[model samples]
Target: MAATAAVAVACGAPAEEPAPEAPHGYVAGAEETAEVQSRLVVADAAGAVRVLDLATEEVVEAGRVDGVGSVTGDGRHAYLASDDGSVRIVDSGSWTVDHGDHTHYYRAAVREVGSVPGADPVAVHADQAVTALALADGTVALLDRARLDEGAVVELATIPRTPHRGPAVPYEGHVLASVAEPGQQFGSGVAVHDRAGAPVATIDEPCPALEGAAVTRRGVVFGCADGALLVSGSDGAFAGEKIPYPQAVTADERVREFRHRPGSALLTARAGEAGIWALDVTARTWTRHDTGPVAAVNSAGAGTALLTLTADGVLHALDPASGAELAATPLLTAPVAPGVRIEVDTSRAYVNDPAAGVIHEIDYADALRVARTFDLGGTPSRMVETGR
Candidate 1:
């Protein structure tokens, strides 16, 4: 990792300076060879950040962050939301850059970056090399991705808070944040703000009791008890359009959280004791589906299918558009601990079976079959695939 390499360099002579230039983003192409290393970056109860490589089926104790129990990350960096008022950022050093015919990859020495202070950095969203943190106190902050890599940060904007728990999702030129009326205790709507923390519109649309939020290729979507608010556009101006749920999704049955991936406009959520709820962000439509008492759900292949891991240990893949069941396969028989999560990408879906200290990689396209089981060692309550 980067920390080890740093200590070794200190015992050697001063580093030599070299010239570099790449047409794309940071780390220049000439300096970035095909050294791509992707893995499942996890934060555990032991304050440790572990990396599991699927190819080698080996676990690497990357590093540790005190008080880190869960994590979220893009392919380049993993952001740990501490219970305290600060956020810890770790460079996963696993990323890919497309160069037309070939994709250039690099394996950076993973290291800890600077921390962002807040009332509680509940969520961190990264895009186009920019990072935005939403705090439990309703503080929304914008930061420079380059500065984060340098173990420092450039605060571009600090959207004032009103003491709420939610996320500030970043887009091309703007951010979407949950809005709370003054003197109110919780968030009741969603609003768009400029990079300077100015409101893009005069009015904030109601989304009382916002629970789940996701950033898709098209825009941002926030789950609400009533329905959902889909924010589109960018720059200093944006629009929040309501995507009301159908009559079938009554107050007794609504998803509080949603999960989605890049390129896909569909978001999957657990419809509280009911089943799965698919929200099409682009079309702003809702599709009713069931995963049979699922513990977790996720989307893959640009919203082609929805994957879920039932509480009964069965994995199911459903077509996202029509809510049709595509495949089903039993992967486990043990009862989950309310922490099992399902994650999917273009091809496969990965399930973390912490009780067995293993991860089930399912072939979703074929028939939701267990392709391989990786003995990751230790209990990983949650995990995110940091490999592209």
Candidate 2:
């Protein structure tokens, strides 16, 4: 990988003042790093938030929140939703900026920015200009992303509709949100809207019972009753295509939430207690790997083993191509707690054991080797990694 290109000067020429280094991928209060500066934003049931540095293993307090119902992250900031209908934003201080061919890593001081009245927020999505918070009441608040970076919670616009069950996705200067038909309780399809919250166009393909949504390199995906819907936009024109399951899937065994590395097309999710679901967005295919009683599932991307944690507290690495168990290791002694997750990066995968107050790090490529175990003092009920 090329970094910091050097310009040659003639041997006999007088040395000219070096041009000021360009401020490429620069953030106001962040320091660019030579390598990925990954950190975990972990929160306990009692609302205590902590930041664990992966490189130095140093844990630091990042303030506290209360009544946290759910937690989500956007590669940099952690969004914590409280039961009292509010959301708190915490800057993880580590992030990556990908320029297709090259990437840059940065680290800053972690802190809690502020809170917003979200009315029981379910998800948060962010892009360069907008940060959308989708609430359970079907109200989507579009916040200014630039203001959010400076510790402000400014809502630029609000899109109110019938109560739906998915996020209002920000994409290509527009927003893609789930839509519900009259008398329907859940979302039936997705619609595209301009930045001003005006409906622009609706995806022709119907996405019944939309439950989950994720942003990938190919486009934005929404989980439907029968299958998944992939939507992409270009120059204000949007289109959708359905990717149905290879076989019949019961409602209880459908893949809802998706997990994967940022910008990766390989999406993984628990397919009930039967197995794990892997969706290849680029190829428009879905593969189900039988991983019985899984607690969590994730993948680094294509060509990586599927990292799965079974309910019995065992971490198993399965070959994605054939669904064959390649390796396994027991990482926890206590019963696996609710909300356990397997966060995967290029080299390592992390699983939090709330009952044991520890997090296991596995080198996925090395036969699922246990590279490190972090004994956090408190229960990590919710955790998300930044700086991929």
Candidate 3:
């Protein structure tokens, strides 16, 4: 953890100086004091996870896991799903491994039993059980969180062969999953499962490949190929509304990622030529904001979104409701050649420059200003904030 430093220049300085270049590696103790503290966890391309303190702008802790995938947090514990068939847990408070030995803090080993090839863990249910899909073997398995340290995950249930990638949202009491063929133009479907992990219903329609899925307070929203969006209710009934993209948009122009702002009625993302689109489920309308080639998008509190540009490494905070630019800051002075991934909380944002193996902290309250930076030993792929 590094302490903050205030750079000074004479008011009557004769010449203007260029901003300092971002340092590389783990530069410790550079902390920032802000009104609110937000945590950002980021994974670099090399599959390592780093936990950052947004308010202090410091790299509190760092850990490496193989094949890191999706990250989810309950505002207390940060869960990292790995492709090595395990889930790693971290106490967000101390930025240390959760379980024990700091090494095996929160680890659950899930073996591929019954001839089914192992799949990367996707979504964690509301109750914390994890859902994973075996694409090659066409199997879906649910693992209980309580039995994580027993060297084997307690298998909850399984679904037969289906082509789908899932964060399978667990809504009300049922878990939802999707199935779609990559090359197929249409004809995809979703499945609903009871709390016991038994299939209750299946929905098949002309949906594109599922890109992102989220369970909102109101309903379930799933992103599809060809800019098709679907919403379902808690009763496993369709909402009778399909949000179709503009006629100019094609299947090739599909949404890659989505993040639902807590307590918001809108979902924001980087969509095709439409750039950052704000889809209002309540209003049943879509508004696009022109953000040039968005490299990453993250939630910035309720009804707000953070968009990052790959070319310049500039971050823009937007109002999800009106698509307005709330604040902007330059995280990286130069272009992040390999690109960077961002993780945001209501109070702060963390930017990972993998090329430099450094994590930059930006203070959201100060209009996304660079608060501090950290250098880590290994490249980070994803990050989450766990409050211990």
Candidate 4:
């Protein structure tokens, strides 16, 4: 461990004095003014957080938590949800704050900035304004991320605990949460609320069993049994529009789980036993593909292609438009049980071989072959790669 550094940026004003002249400490591997970058955050079964540098493919930092749920990132930091019902904001220590003339690159310890309470951590806005927390009891807490950056955990609103398993999305001053139809297991509607937790509107647009959710540049979308729910607008005037599945695509075998990086316009999900669906956010469309019982997935390219891993340790790249199999790479050396998973972004695809205590990195644009492999020497139960 090293000493920590703190730097905050308040835009829209020129510096009162010229930026401080200083001797540099730990500099980021990439320049702040360069294109955006991200690092991987891995949470092991022993309740420890291990970070692997995306470039080096080596563990760089380690920390501890109660348990790992969803980990959300905003380029500058990561907010991780634990089994203990706490959300700890970990400084990714690799970020850039843009100013007019120059950008400030930063490197800090993998430290906890602040936290809030909820059984699970959900969405983090693209600009890092707020974070949403969800619980199995169907409660959602929207916390202010800007306050967390100021070393505060301010809860903006908490939707009462309902009887459904759903997550919430936060816009400027409003939140959208999925709700189940009365006495039904599927969530066919969404409840909208203001910052004060006051109900604004309830949208019933027929997206049965809403489960998978992703926030895109276009808007926030949720997966449904019949189709997807696309939410547009901002602040108090948010609108929910239903994008129904084409009549050619039936709902009986639709996927309820979608995996994607928050703020990514593209989303990928699994359909039934061996089906894959690529969602295009810009046009609000769904394209079907197959990955043969995919266990876990992370997608990119706005529904262009998908990097997927089946339950049997085989990784496949499929053409999102035509359900064509592009490539396949066997990921594991030894057979393991079901539940191993893969996470992919624009740069690389990370696959965890839990049975071998290893994580494999593949060049997605190349032949889908292993570029690097990490021998962790221990199994990592839950993992999330940060860097878009």
Number of the top lDDT candidate:
2
Total clashing pairs for each candidate: 0, 0, 27, 0
lDDT per residue (tens digit) for residues 217-333 in model 1? 677777787788877774456777788888656665786778876547878888877788888777778887754567888887453678877777877777776667888887766
Write candidate 4's Cα lDDT for 125-203 as tens digits.
4345656676666777766766765556777777784567776777555777787755665456777777666788877
Q: How does each model score on TM-score? A: 0.83, 0.92, 0.68, 0.79
Report lDDT (Cα) of residue 7, candidate 4.
Answer: 29
Q: In model 1, what are the clashing residue pairs, if there are any?
A: none
The true-versus-predicted C-alpha distance at residue 74 of model 3, in Å, is 6.1
Model 3 per-residue lDDT tens digits across residues 233-296: 5555544246776545555456656655443456667765546666676766666666656777
Per residue, candidate 2 scores C-alpha lDDT tens digits across 1-388 of: 1332323334556878998876878778889999999999898877798999999898889888776667888888888887787888888888888787998999888878888964587678888788888888888898888787788888889888887666789997899998997677679898898877888899999998887888998999988878899999889999999999899998878877888987889999888878889999999999998767688889999999888888788888889889999999988764778888888888899988888888889999999898999987888888999887
3 versus 4: better TM-score goes to:
4
The TM-score obtained by model 1 is 0.83
The positional error of residue 281 in candidate 4, measured at the CA in angstroms, is: 2.6
Q: What lDDT, from 0 to 1, does candidate 1 have?
A: 0.72
lDDT per model vs. reference: 0.72, 0.85, 0.55, 0.67
lDDT of 1 at 347: 72
Minimum summed lDDT over a 10-residue window in model 2 is located at: 1-10
Flag regions of model 4 displaced more than 4 Å: 1-33, 56-58, 66-81, 84-89, 95-107, 114-127, 150-152, 181-186, 234-236, 247-252, 333-339
Q: Quick one: ranking by lDDT, best first?
A: 2, 1, 4, 3
Total colliding residue pairs, candidate 3? 27
